[model samples]
Target: PGPLSPSPPQLRAQPQGAMQVGVQARELRQPMAMAMAAAAPGQMVMSAGMQQLAMLPCIDVQERAQWLQEATALLGAEIEMANKYRVLDQVGNQFFYAVEKTDCCRRQCQNGLCADCTSWEVDVLYTPPGGLMQKFLALRRPCSCVCCCINRPTADVIDEATGQKIGSFRDPCTCCSLRFQVRDASDTDVLVVNGGCCCTQPGILCPLPCGPCAQVRFDVEDAESRSTVARITKRVPSCLSWFFAPDVDSYHVTFEHIQNPQWKAIMLAFTIFMDFRYFNVNRNQEQARDVLAEL
Candidate 1:
């Protein structure tokens, strides 16, 4: 579609309860992990496991937030780039149209020279969708100038050689794609669901220190002027175990998606580092057990 003027798009109905429900479930899991840790303090092994799982939710939250922020910033940058191009249809362009006081007096006044009026009223042509026109409307109050408050006039596209109006321009329609899938450890148990309102690209894997096992799908409404929504889910069982565990150990860690763009990459990298740390911790534990056995 040609660039839509900056006038607010029509709002659509939103999937009201879904996002909140997912958030609440995520939040609830944290306290549940804490309770488990308290109950299994003597079982240091179990407590540690639970704590590790608890950390996953926290990490997921942080990561998600970070990605959301980054994505929003990127959206802003895209808009700015469009503005820099100054590409607009006739109805989407706005400009200042000023006439000197003398010209106004000579054209409209009974006397050729209107001595009382120092300046002529200036009319500003404002278009919709484009940022420049929006800004003009915001800054300039309503006035009597003919151009200042006029609706966009239609223009016919005429072929210079043929001297005929061409009817080739067509408005573009909005379209989107969304997909969801779950894969098991062997990567063989792949279940795919396709066709939704959002994009279908796979999310980055932020593996927990433990490992990956199951993936879940999540859907949420897009934050556009239009109330478009989308769904996506990735589950790693190893990560889920850590997310659900109750006790924290030196090796415990969590993976969260905090809606930040860079967060997914950062969290994924952090999780890989934590996995190495977990391996070292396990090696140390094994060595200590051997010594105890010998003693």
Candidate 2:
């Protein structure tokens, strides 16, 4: 995996539903993490937690788009799989490679023994490159990114290296725009991410705070003061990429105002979670559409 170039995901037959995706998300593995940790020991940037938010140069460096581009989203159009992203710094320097992984055995286990696996829990891993090889930030979320108006998407952020629960993101279920509450480990709301205000109560001809547009953004604001402290942005590649491979997109995070490393890590985790929840073209949406067509 070159810094910005990740080989296509392993081609396998993905099942037809979200529950199956959930069955495969867990337990006893870090092979991919191990491999990359050994190979790119030098590429390892400073840790952001106990390591501190010392990598400002790498974090804020020119604010150039640091992409976590999806793995070959279009080598074959119909192949559906977990999301894989090539993380790069603002200058296009490869920093971390991210991918979501699952265990397929549970699909047939039918024995109800896979208690460790939650209904929609997804374990995303990154190593020195892949091998679960090592854990950076382990994120938990629903397998299906798409949710009806009743289902508000939420995600949890965990620091794997330290094995500490950092925080979580919860949606307010606003339909007209995008809004998520960024809460600390205590589940206390600390920051609010607004999708640029579209008014859910009235709700019409309004653009969602999170959309497919190239520069869609969600501003991270302080809960108490309600001041913009940081920002998360979504960027798309060429027109061809968006159409053929909807999952491939770039995300930029700004931390000039908020310097805490733990919160920063939480924000980063949410960015990945948000990408899958808002950007990826996974199985859930396709199945929903099929059901709708049949109806």
Candidate 3:
């Protein structure tokens, strides 16, 4: 028989770096129109202040071979996983990379920033399987202040090349268990984030524990049915990781077998956010001091 059909795209590898884009506020209205048409009777009703948002471009990764090649080139030996990634950037200081949870650069210092510093708006480069190097995603953390500290701090999800606003992850508030929204251009809610516990343990998760470590379940849901599409189990760093070294917070995100690339990307962004919320909360002060001095 002739050669069998090519394998599907392997989406196991995660992208690194980030890109910036120009986002127009008006583009968010399209998805709401589409969603409203499909919403159940009572579900489409919006409150007086509600708004509409756009949906992300449809991304299909079923092509296994192509996806695998891209994953290998970008992640390099790291296993490819959908919706699972570790926070490669540090906190308190600007500039960092969101490396794959499996593949990471161990070099002490590359470029001007060390491997352990917090990153701001880093570009994620990708070439697809047979494509050329292009900006994939950019991680950006906006500065926060005391007044807005308790507010659910959010990270802007920017499309590096076009500077378009693909989507944004609104983190859970520090004080409450309120729902968060993964919004698109029109700020329309694409995925609803609800039902999860936060990681409040101060130290590590080992022999000498500062506090009990619990995994926060970040459940991403559909805007209509409110059914779960993906879930991320996030836990605090270990004692050694928290105090001594810079480590990516431990977490696992799993998506439904058939998923949209846009949603997958949103889930990945959540992982990055969780990393900042958990590990960075217990940031290494000494490291922060040194990082600040370097700036």
Each candidate's lDDT (Cα)?
A: 0.23, 0.49, 0.41
Better of 1 and 2 by TM-score: 2
Per-residue CA lDDT of model 1 for 1-295, tens digit only, reads 2211111111233357532212111111111111222343332222221222223333221111123322333333211010011211223331211111224222233111321222222111222333243111001111122221242111122212222222111111224433322221122211222324423322223224432213324333222221222233333334323332211122111222223211211222222222211111111223334544587
For every model shown, what is its TM-score relative to the native structure?
0.16, 0.59, 0.47
Best by TM-score: 2
lDDT of 2 by residue, 1-295 (tens): 3221111111122356432211111111211221223345334333423243335322321111212222322222233344556555566655455666534442222113332122233443433323234456777764333345544566777667545566788766664676778777667777788766434222112212234334666777766656576777666556544433444567778764554445666667777766554454322334334544587
Q: What are the runs in model 3 whose C-alpha is more than 4 Å off?
A: 1-119, 127-133, 144-152, 172-174, 198-214, 235-243, 283-295
**How do these models rank on TM-score, best leading?**
2, 3, 1
Ranking by lDDT: 2, 3, 1
What lDDT would candidate 2 get against the real structure? 0.49
The TM-score between candidate 1 and the true structure equals 0.16
The reply for model 1, stretches above 4 Å from the true place, is 1-50, 54-176, 190-195, 198-217, 220-295
Question: For all the candidates, what are their Cα RMSDs to the real structure?
Answer: 30.8, 15.3, 16.5
